[model samples]
Target chain A: MNEYKILFTGTMGAGKTTAIGSVSEAAPIVTDVANTDLSLGKERTTVGLDFGLLTLASGDRIRLFGTPGQQRFDFLWKILAKSAIGLIILVDNSRSDPLADLVVYLDGFAEDLSVLPCAIGIGRLDTHPVPTLEDYIDILANRNQLVPIMSVDVRRREDVVLLIDTLLAQLEANTFGA
Target chain B: MTILRFGIPHLSDPEVRLVKAFFRLYSQDPTFRWTIVEGPPYDVLLVDESVSEDVVAGTVLTLTPVKSELPNTLERPLRSDHLEAWLKKAEYDLRNARLQPQPPEEQPIDEQRIDPTSSSHFKLRRWPPPALLGSNPVRVRMATLISRRALRLDEMAAITEQPLAECAAVVNLLRGAGLIEIQDLPDKPMTMGRAGGRFADQSVKQSFVSGVRNKLGL
Candidate 1:
């Protein structure tokens, strides 16, 4: 009966919605609308967030929440970020600066939301030659930060499960006194 | 569907408490089927089917064979009709996934709003930057330290040379960032001898339940 809320966030077209649909049992309840922002270079933007519900075999259900990619929607992110047990931060590999995108969410969370459990899923590692997990971890490493850095194909379930499991374990450690 | 086997070399640790993680996430589904196997990764969960295209791309620590596929084993048994039926029910939702619409009042929850109170339930303080040897010196050092041993509060403080409260702060920060884990002592840390021993002992089930409750922040 217990359900953990899992959120997928990152840059535009980082595959957040697809990742949720790939693993969700019930059809993912998505707020995916075409991008209209000029940042998209005249592309469509997701005016709202995407939604998915995944019930693990243990009967534990996790609501997969996806946030809009634009920085302007950062306000909405604070509201959507409530009760999130883990974060699957989808990064766009094709970009020249993926670290900037990572920092965008990292700083956004630190600035806007409550301190909650989270992780980084290096999305689109398959398409672009980004840093390795070890390399990326090095980029995000700090003393107080226990971010689990890994490459993730948003479209895969096993990868999502591993990411979710790692996040859940960390959440448990945080909640249960480790 | 692609089924891959992975080994998590450290599951044997009595304190690792992995089953606690596994059961917490999977115990709800009536039709879920999983088997834990022992191998190089130390633990393997047999997923009956694949979940996404990205599932196959992560580091292939190595693709291990299922127990039934061992060279010396007999032929694999076929699934019975009932077993097949169970798989169908479980697979139906996964295979035929769609997008469900949310009602207007029920807006999707964002993690930032999860804790709106001014008092911080989770507090984090940063550790000293990693030992600078290479480009990502700090991250590498921290990862090595985390994988090697239990990163208790005192040890973290020793490294940062900060006050105990500050040490707790830093640990919480690292915990939030997903860099380390915090483990509570079975009872208050100061308790000793009979006073500590006299604390109400929990039954196995109670202990497990309590442990889970603590982790879930329930």
Candidate 2:
């Protein structure tokens, strides 16, 4: 069976770990530590990588890896992203500036994003409705990047799967030059 | 009752009568008071495609797109449902703006007595004030859950199938907005053993599968 490596990256409190855990067949392996960053307002935070596995109906294995959210661990992001078939960038809309947050991920994965199929999952949009989905589309359009973007609650397995399906669909579309 | 003044500029007599007829239907409604005005100081201006630019210098809801996405423009061939929806959104937005925080000294203080020895100075509010609408779905779901019963962030995440981080963000936003009353959980010890934990895991997996099936229509 073929194996596909997928990377999920986002801001510190964007729910990458929960999203991975929600869809993985087995209990996800999480390496979290006591959060010293009080500014993040969370008691515990992912310090290392989170790993999960899902087997598709076609007998393909999908390895899900989540990078630690802090920009300080960006080195690990590249390390984890290596050989990954697709990227899922989660954006927390409730942040001070969500569009700017999206730009950070876009810039961080600049090389991989150019070739690899990528999807953006925006969370908390119901509350932070100012920078609408159209706003994100406009930003991507301005940057000359075309990708599928959707509102997602990562804790839902279906939503997480939808992101993966969207990425795969994009890859399929690109393969056929549709 | 809030009075919303409207100006329909440069329309024929029959068209003006049609607009007035639309307003008359909602005239009996207690919450919305609409007044058809001739000139300035109108709250909203509904202009036809041929209406000149210098008609009024205020909020304009045009029949067609004028220049670069006018905020309140309604497309041609207005529908009652669409008009009602737009007015509701306008009213909601106005209420939200009014509910925004004023200067500290000018802010109204809650009259509820506070316990000085409490760990946190803020008291948990039960019902979200009506002013707290149009928030993110996560926050709205969390509010609904909280309204039903007190819950922790994790519990809220599980119930709503939202990410823990997203749930935490929503909780923080609600707390910061003073729209939620946090109920402290009683300190309890873990009693579930390994076998129980395994069963709980299976249950969670089963529920997740069912949820996915339902969401995907599989």
Instruction: Tell me each candidate's TM-score.
Output: 0.46, 0.48
Q: Compared with the true structure, what per-residue lDDT tens digits does model 1 show for residues B59-105?
A: 22221233344321212232234223433443454334313555766
**Which pairs of residues collide in model 2?**
A126-B135, A126-B136, A126-B137, A127-B135, A127-B136, B124-B181, B125-B181
Model 2, stretches more than 4 Å misplaced?
A57-59, B1-218
Using lDDT, give the best candidate's number.
2
lDDT of 1 at A127: 62
- In model 1, which runs have C-alpha deviations exceeding 4 angstroms? A1-3, A37-44, A56-60, A111-115, A142-144, A175-178, B1-218
Question: How many angstroms is residue B182 displaced in model 1 relative to the true structure, after the best TM-score fit?
Answer: 14
lDDT per residue as tens, model 1, A2-114: 65566788888777878888777677776766666555553554667778875544555567888888888888777766656566777877766887787889877874222
Q: DockQ for the candidate 1 complex?
A: 0.02
Q: Is the docking of candidate 2 incorrect, acceptable, medium or high quality?
A: incorrect
Q: What share of the true interface contacts does each candidate keep?
A: 0.00, 0.00
